[model samples]
Target chain A: MPTWSRRSPPGWSWPMAEKKMVDVFSDVERETAMTANPAGYAVTELGAEDERIVTLAADMSNTVAEFIAKFPERYIECGIAETNSVSLAAGLASAGLIPYIYSMSPFGMLKTCEQWRTDVDYNHLPVRLVGRLSGLAMGYFGTSHYAVEDIAIARTMNNTVVLSPGDAASCVSLMRSTASLEVPVYIRIAEAVSRVYDEAPDYEFGKWPRLRTGSDVTLIGHGMGLGLCAAAAEALYEHDSIEADVFDAAYLRPYDETALLASAAKTGHVLTVEEHSVAGGLGSLVAEAIARAGLSVRLGQVALPDKDLEVGVPADLYEYYGLTPSNVAAKARSLVRR
Target chain B: MPADITLERGRALTEAELLRRADWVRLQTIDLIAQAGLGHYSSTFSCAELVATLYYHALRLRPAEPNWPDRDRFLLGKGHVATGLWPVLADLGYYPHDWLKQFGKVGSPLNDHPNMKLAHGIDFSSGSLGHNLSVGAGMALAARLTGRDYRTFVLTGDGELQEGQVWEAAMAASHYKLGNLVAIIDANGFSGAGPTSQAMNIEPLAKRFEAFGWTVREIDGHHAPVLLRTFDELPDPASEEPVAIIARTRKGHGVEFMEKQPQAWHLGLLNAEQYADVVAEISARMELANG
Candidate 1:
């Protein structure tokens, strides 16, 4: 009943406080961990449970097909025929079997886009679209292979739910749930496995989970970028007095309205981070929500440029675009001081 | 000649009725296109008899229950001729005849192409060429998976063969040996810009399908009895391979003015005098059959 304050004391902590600590999970760690790339192990586990879950790859199996070989009958080796593979998967989806259509991000999502839209989305059919190497994960593969515009295009569709899971556990949970989903789901799979949540990490579709809470600044990131945000938050606390609240938005299309509002209200300053183009990534969605809700938060966007990214490794590109922890921490410091 | 039948039924379609309906379907397509200001009339006219044969006699479908699991599926891969499909569907009681009255109107479900979500009796939305064949392949596979005896039919324009996805499905169908699936290619010489031979010519059409492990057949598209006989006697999906029926057709079969003229392929409007000529011509053909 006390007067509410953005910087409320410890007594004001919500139920989410008990679930805030990051538990260590070692099932699918790739030497390093981040908040992005939740789908790696879950995709593998879902493949283990269901024999009908097939993964079709267009020459890229290293980064995305880890789970495919576990169930051979559930995988098809279609070399470079993106359109045919998509159409065939759509056909297979009709057979009551879930088919995960996988390929590189740009080639998979944009190359056979028309076929995907026609065969999968328009049909309102449940065909899992997996963009294996999302965003700048192609590294030296250059601008031609980078899938920076996927979120925007996928958002325009009717029955297609776009997902950018930020850890292995979330990815596995979402993949398993997609079996019963009536609509199409597009998962942008990051090249590296970032973080592993605790065994009891309850995941929900279209809902954002708050990892860290602070009153000074709110940091929002999705998919692979979420790890960067989490890393940046830790850096900010060590170097500067600013405490930032970090939220992981797994579903890109339907943003979590309640989490977005609460975060925006808590901190007048909000920053969105993504590996996709700044034009239509999480930044655009958060900004739109802020404007709609009539909230007066100063929104800062951190995403790749609208133009094609230069050739480099995923880490180099992430650093080049100030997507690394130190760079994000510096950007947050500058914005908070302003 | 009368269509081959079980003898007691006499014919799949009376020769006179076949001739009259084929002509009617052709002219009606032209009229609808002209009225709607859009259609693939040339392609529609070419496949008129084949479509008429299926609707009037061959396909075991119930218009009342379009989603009946046991009902046979007829998927039109070349969906530009949605104008032609409307009347045939209406005649078959798939929809009311008055539904065509709103063709091309704003917000009307009856667009230039068929959309499964927007329109009833349409199993799949097509227009992005070569898609329906794969969808039909899936439907055929679904029948097998569900243990249903229903067969699946897909019609693709010969020009649409240029799409590589079609060949992919063609290969899949052959490899899976989907004999319950019959793909009919309306081999009209002309396409959108000009004659297909002048565009990207693909000849020996039936041979190409055969190489893909399909049971292929070539037939005169204008001949209704031949089409009826083949459709009625189609093999089961358990056959060694899928089936492809290549229908050799002229661009515009009944309408002399539009015949072979690709420009007239889908003119959705005809002046009063032109309309009169079409009506008179159809009247004469009907009278000749009656006499």
Candidate 2:
């Protein structure tokens, strides 16, 4: 029975310790911070130029305190009610405002999924949805909070653009790109990622961003898995003498069929990586597209198992789910050697 | 006229004129529904006078520009009621009357529910029950944030209250002090299954809204003048609360043989006998009111 104050002993906060562990991967994690999450922040940045930019959140304004500090009027905290937060955002869009809604991934996307599909997607309103700590990032919190199937559910909706930025830099870039889209966009974020890609190539909303080039095998990763994929590819060259191609399918819904087809043609073997469940996720989408196009490529997926996850540190969970560099590297080696 | 049920002097219209307009809208809805051979005609017929009063004398709107930011937003939560909504939109000049001829047709914007894309005057797409109230609250909140005078009004079916999400939104609307948002529950005592009371009694509906911190009003929904006045005279939400007016109405209000008949809850190809009965009843009421 201890009070949760900032003055508490060093190890008082589990989330704080969790933050430290994620920092070890800071080299790559920092590359994927969210661009337009907590709609309050994104709207303030865009509202200066576009009067239509507005934001609504599910009583989580304190998480994006800086945005609220800067633009109090634009931020709305619906006090822990995710359903109202979504419905309100739809209403704002109907009133001619570009609305962005922010909430935890599970509640914001899954819990209010029907509202998202019927109210926003069906209407094709420019309502931006930002989901934080997606996938197993909420590992310690258990099933109710984890957004493991967000990508799978969102991809099924028509006229929806799903973005999973690998690092903070890409998060910001993707945010600015998808902000002006006429249709709804779902942006999944994993804060403080480690890998930072070179900013030389311009980022496109629906096009996959290539982080590393290789001819022997193709490693596909979305959102937080990009760094692991890159590390895995590098390890393949160092230990096994196989040059693996690392492609970031930043946008999950509109899978880059052309890039995927071309890479499959070059490598002949494809491996998709993500922190989401294997069922109906990025891997399934890729496999379906490759099969449809009649492409002769061996497709493989490295993903979290479909079940309720146990509580633990994020790194431990990531490692357990075969998302770490070592596991990813091993998977790549086996695929290329096969 | 009860002084309390009087509309603003300038906007008020004779009950005969309102009833005539409502009847015309009803005829248009019947034609469209019959042509489509599928619709929520019974539910829509029940709300005709209420919608007519609001558009003509209550809500501030611009049919020419449906997306006018300053315009008042009207959300139809009872989506099954869309079958009747088509003609009302046309009568308001939101679209041509001919457009409704394509109701339920493939590629026609007019589906069973109101779609802002296919037609004008609808603020949001609502066929899924218990969603429009929150959207209206959002519009009202947006008005407050932007410092606009526009208000938001939502009309939902009594059965839709069964959704837990509706109460969730009801609580949020009151918490935000959305005085600019007004909810009108069409308590016609019927739902998809049967009588709303039998399905689930929502008695003391006004008290339920009042308990959630809303200004409450109960009135006969078919009375145009009373309906218009209720909208006009809505209390300032009595200390920043939202407003809810429980509209007491019959499931099939205008047409005889359909009213209070659970079997007539939703009409199918109106048989010659039933159609003749409805036509005779409406003609008699139209004459009595006209006289």
Candidate 3:
């Protein structure tokens, strides 16, 4: 079982030192034990229910292997053409079929931005674009494979619902929820992290999930960043007796403004952490929201610098960029103390 | 439906009537562009007969039911020539003929490009080049998956062949053997800048498509009999090979001055005297054909 399985009631403050000491290997092991790849399972399940659900792969078959195996006729291998695949999905959607295109983040989102803009979003077609290995998860593959700019691009498109899943369970739940959506959706799938929920949480579009409660500061994150926020909250309490509110900002486009304002009002300080550029990722989104709401709250960001990043193992890169729990906690402590 | 029009799905038109309709398309296109003051007149003129054949004779569509699920779909990859298609849709009662005068105006559904959401009878929105073929392939694949027999036809420009995504779609369409998809390339010899060969040669076009595993056919685009015969003999939807029709045509076929200077007339406004000349020429041709 994962160490995060323990539930903490709202307004409850507890030191997470014991849980923090748990090795990263055990977390990976727990994730594998829970589910191998929740996306593949979820797609196969959705295929059984909706015959209109078809999948197009840009030569990324392994990401949706189970669905291809079960419903081979419904799977289209679009070669390595991401642009053509997106337009193809739009064509299918125009003809009363819901099509999903799955590929690595760079090829899926960055390479086919115009296709998504003109072919899918402009036409208001219900095409699902799934981009895996989001952010710096493609660690050693260098800057070419990094998806730090995907969120910025996706959010700029009209009639597109942008979402990032925090864990395997949320990945399944978020994808399944998009079945009845009549507009295009872009689902960013981050690298596997420890399970945040025992089962799938009831998800609502434009609503943020409050993972832990605190009064000193609010830590907002999405996808892999959410897990880091939870760990940083525990560390803040353990080291400096500072309670930090942690939130999962899964829906980036239609983000929950009411919850964000209430949390900012309660904490008076907001810090956003993400495995993306500090320019237009979650940090920029929060800043825009804060300004639009005219809230007088201090905001800080813990994100990758907006420049060319170095190539190395993901763990080494995270440590060098100050994305670890300790670095996040230290940043939160400074924000609360100031 | 319009009170002045009778709705007939797949009405068999005579060769002479088809030719007359093609001339009517040219006349309407000239009028629309002359009204809009900024439109692709030559581009519309090049594909006039092809568009008329598809709308009046080739396609299976109901004017009363534009969104019929089983209706055949038509996408304009070279969407700048949408002026030619709008009039046909209006005549079919997809919308009122009065909307043709509102072309390119603010809030008008009829822009220089085709938008499926804004306009009736447009199967897909297309302005950016080289996207509609892939969209057609997608619709073709959808037909097979959904067990529907609706065919999808895409009209692409010769210059649009330069876009990499077009070939990407070409490769995928042939790879999937999308027999329900038909690509009609308007090889009018000129693009917006100049002649396609001088700008970027896409010659040996038929062999290129043959190499991509598509059934290739070439014909004089302006000839009504050839256009009708080629469309009638298209491969079955259940067949294994997609079809590519390379329609050899002039940049501006009917108008004498425009045909002479295809490069200059690619996009230009006609003065009152020039518009009168074009009208007289088309009317003379109609009278000659009728006699």
Candidate 4:
């Protein structure tokens, strides 16, 4: 088991040494202290504001219990069929109603890929597909419940927006902000996430939120990975005297290319951390951006491998798969050194 | 409320007129597919009366106002038959008649399948089978929630029932008690490969829907009077059970040669000589129906 180093590096000067460094690791710890699902509260609040807002659940009503309690008439229980729920949402959208369908991540996005392609995005309907317990948050439930391939599948859909919020506040803010979007949206939500913000920061679609600034390396992550990246950046600075910039890459599709290029130019090295597979998640998106711009910056990724993963508690799985802060920091150090 | 079968375009259509319209649908479909270079002729021929009756006598619509808030909605799950629907929408003035000449051409809205985004009157776009039933159920549920009295109709192919999502939608629609939703299965016997039963038997389809809690009605799809009466006698929007009408139809009805070999005619190009024969056959049928 790898552990984060607390000892400061000797005879190294921090570039932003004078600036007050926020304890990002502590912030992440605070964020993970949530007890209730933020999406339920956010959607409930949205239903109160917009009459068109309706929620459909596929045997996952607990994820949006608040919305169900507040707006029982608008809450539709589609039982356990994810494919039907997705198309049903599209049908509701066609009739000028805004619908949000909720399910476990794997079933919500991967199992209904065709429905999303033909029924929802192809029609350009405004349906919100909410996938809870993304990544390995399903823990011992194993790969059947895991959603590492969801981002890859969702980003390929035309006229669709892909969102992954980092913390409870950001999740709420993102849900509220994207309530009336004209195009379909796939929102990836973890069961629990570390705090990347003190409150709901103002969210802009297709833009990355800069969490911490540095000149040595850029660290990008989203959803559960954002907190890990923030903590990793903190560890890198404390142990190896490496100043790393951290960004919350919330939007997977229509990513913030300008910010990515500018950060790569400034830092010369980029590291992406995600709970998804390295093939088509945040790492691939960043790699595509860097390669498209013909940038000479070196890129490193700390993510799950492209293979079937084993079943375990989320913490043990994160440690084994190198999804912890220590693993991210080690990968960042290697990138900076190279 | 049941559809007002007596009035269409502010005038009553006689049974002979509706039968003539069905023949016209067959003729127009042949012309459209001949121009497009490729299409599903047998599939369109199978549901000619169902399409004609829905658009002419069964549906409430303001043709000039295609986006009427309370209008009846129709979805084509067996979307290959979209060629049969374009002519009816054009005749109703949904879009210009010239659009039909450009069918399947690049940048044309009239593709082989329905696209609600590109076309004016399509309630929902469909190509991949087994999705429109769920979509139609959603529309019906929306009407129920919003206090709207519009009915949603979905036409699916018999082979389309092989897709598991169709059953998923069937179970859910019945579970939700969506009475405003009606599913018309065009059981034309043949699919793209061969006969639907040989490929993947969806036999006892009526019993299957009934077991899922839908009110089932089996009818002869090619009969104009039966088609209109079935649509007119649909369950009320406020009823508890969804309705499924099993429309038993021939793969190809009017054209003699195509009727004999449905598998080969499933998708084919009609040359000028064959097109003339098909048009003449439908014309003679229309005249006989008129008499």
Q: In DockQ, how does model 2 score against the reference complex?
A: 0.70
Question: Residue B73 in candidate 4 has what lDDT?
Answer: 87
Q: For residues A175-239, write the lDDT of model 1, one tens digit per residue.
A: 77665687888888765436635542455768877888888899988876788889889888887
Off by over 4 Å in 1: A1-55, A59-77, A94-97, A292-294, B1-11
Best by TM-score: 3
Clashing pairs in 3: none
DockQ-best of 2 and 4: 4
Q: Using lDDT, rank the candidates from best to worst.
A: 3, 4, 2, 1
Model 3 over residues A1-338: C-alpha lDDT tens digits? 65663778788897543323123223453445226566777888899999899998888898788899889999999988999999999999998998989988999889999999999999899999999877877777688988999999999899999998888888888888877899999999877355676777778987988988889999998887888898888888887888888888888988888889999989999999888889888999999989988999999999999988987667667788988888888888888888
Candidate 4 B-chain TM-score = 0.95
**Ranking according to TM-score, highest score first:** 3, 4, 2, 1
Per-residue CA lDDT of model 4 for B1-291, tens digit only, reads 123322232135667888789889998988888787898998899998888888888887866777776888899999989999999999987899999998999999999999998998898999999899989999998998889988898999999999999998898888888998899999999889999889889999988999999999999998867776787788787898999999999998888999999889999998889888888888988888767
Model 2 bad stretches (over 4 Å): A1-44, A47-51, A198-201, B1-12, B235-239
B159-189: candidate 2 lDDT, tens digit per residue:
9998877888899888889998989988888
User: For residue A60, what is the lDDT in candidate 4?
Assistant: 93
Where does the lowest 10-residue lDDT sum fall in candidate 3 chain B?
Answer: B1-10
Looking only at chain B, model 1 earns a TM-score of: 0.92
Candidate 3, which CAPRI tier? medium
Instruction: Quantify all predictions' global Cα lDDT against the true fold.
Output: 0.76, 0.78, 0.87, 0.87
